[model samples]
Target: MALIITDECINCDVCEPECPNEAISQGEEIYIINPALCTECVGHYDVPQCVEVCPVDCISSDPNMVESKEQLQEKYHALMGKQ
Candidate 1:
């Protein structure tokens, strides 16, 4: 599943650069996670990079956008042109 940034975010800007897929960005308010580009760092790291660096622990799985590990791997490959 794609990770989401909650309203608890403090706009710390720490999670943006940590995303290997560049899925995290500054939204009108707090940072937002793009479900299309998000791979939960499956192909890059064991854990989601954004979740790793977020200062407030506002990042979590998007329950509404749930996906399996295989789906996320496919997304990662597709995003990297490996598929």
Candidate 2:
């Protein structure tokens, strides 16, 4: 599943660079994750780097874009160039 930044984000810009997929971005007053590009670090890393580095620990699973492991891997493959 993709991760999301909650309103608790402190706008510290800590989690943006930690994302392997470049999915994190600055919003009006906080950070937002692009669900289409977020694979929860499936192909690039073992865990969600954004969540690992988030200062406020505001990054959490996005319920709106729930996906299984296979589905997430498929999405990663499509984005990273594979069958």
Candidate 3:
């Protein structure tokens, strides 16, 4: 997944359904992204929808789960139809 929920998340459910790939889910105290299902909205929207809707600004790229643009694009297309 390109983004992750920080500890700052107030357990708010604002960022869940906003995900285009259905990647976000509720965790212990906050939401978590399913990396395998997360395409970072690459082939769906122009920007990361989760990052835009997060009230606490708790979403950030996963440093340990790095991916290249091409890889992201492939994932996006795999999950969504290409234009």
Candidate 4:
């Protein structure tokens, strides 16, 4: 599943750099994750790097954009132009 950054984000700036897909960015008042570009780090790591580094635990699975592991892998591959 893709991850979403909650309103609780402190704009700490750590999560932004941890996202392998460059999906995280600074929003008007907090950080945001682009579901279109997020693959939950399927091809890069076992876990979502942004979630791993978020201090307030503001990052979590995006319930609305849920996808299976194979789907995530397909996304990862597509992002890298492998599909």
| TM-scores, one per candidate | 0.97, 0.94, 0.88, 0.96
- Which candidate number maximizes TM-score? 1
Candidate 3, pairs of clashing residues: none
Model 1 RMSD to the real structure?
Answer: 0.6
Tens-digit per-residue lDDT, 25-67, candidate 2: 9998888999999999998888888888876788899888989
lDDT of 3: 0.84
Candidate 3 has its poorest 10 consecutive residues by lDDT at 74-83
CA lDDT, every model vs. true structure: 0.92, 0.88, 0.84, 0.91
Relative to the unseen true structure, what is the C-alpha lDDT of residue 68 in candidate 3, on a scale of 0 to 100? 79
Predictions: Cα RMSD each: 0.6, 0.9, 1.9, 0.7
Summarize candidate 1's per-residue lDDT along 1-83 as a digit string, tens digits.
88889999999999999999999889999899999999999999999988888878999999999999999999999999995
Stretches of candidate 1 exceeding 4 Å from the true structure: none
How much does candidate 4 score in TM-score?
Answer: 0.96
> Of 1 and 4, which scores higher on TM-score?
1
Best by lDDT: 1
